[model samples]
Target: MTVRMTSARKAILEELESSKAHLTINQIHERLSGRLPSLNVSTVYRSLDFLSQNGLISISDMGVGTPVYEIMKEETHHHLVCSSCKQVIELENDLVAPFFEQIEKEKKTKVITNHLVVFGICLECKEY
Candidate 1:
């Protein structure tokens, strides 16, 4: 069954669903103003926390100290964070899967790992 959403919640969901990059609360607040002029920071955060708990979306720290959120459309993915620019890039799990499998085999480990995070400077920041 599909759950119905309140206007405030729907507004938040639309912003995330339409975006490609993960967005911090500030970004969301700004984007929402165009349509949801009555939106406030507290409501945005509260609804986000609820949605995250309900599996509607996922939140990750983009190394900017502010939590960024993305639409959870796919399996858990990894990220590349820029130290200088604070840029976030979403990447599929393929890059690190082989190495992780090798490690698990070497250690005779059967651990259930779901999420992986990788941090590094993006190419734009590297050129500086």
Candidate 2:
């Protein structure tokens, strides 16, 4: 599905691509407001939805109250979120591949999503 790349979409994609942290719609809008004075939250929302649907970006809850968006990369990765501290730890695909494979085999279905967020208490929180 090919969609026209509007200025809003391009700016949104660039913002996500440049950011290491997953951004919410408000964050993205706030960050881009300096450069894109005319950009609105609704446009950001729409662009994010379009980007997510087109596989350019990924939206994950990451144990946060609201969803966060990040640009998709060639090397897929997951997240282990600390439920207490809300610290996000990047989980490598190596650890997840076999688990996904097992699910695929057991369910006889394909696992299409490249990223997953597992919420748990971190070591610090557990020790405390």
lDDT of every predicted structure (CA atoms): 0.78, 0.90
Question: How many clashes in candidate 1?
Answer: 0
What does candidate 2's lDDT look like per residue over 11-54, in tens digits?
99988888867999899999999999999899999989998888
RMSD of 1: 4.2
Give the number of the best model, judged by TM-score.
2
Q: What would you estimate as the lDDT of candidate 1?
A: 0.78
Per-prediction TM-score, please? 0.69, 0.90
lDDT of 1 by residue, 58-107 (tens): 78766778888887767767777677786667667787678678988999
Instruction: Compute the lDDT for candidate 2.
Output: 0.90
Candidate number with greatest lDDT: 2
User: Which stretches of model 1 miss by more than 4 angstroms?
Assistant: 1-4, 85-89, 95-116, 121-128
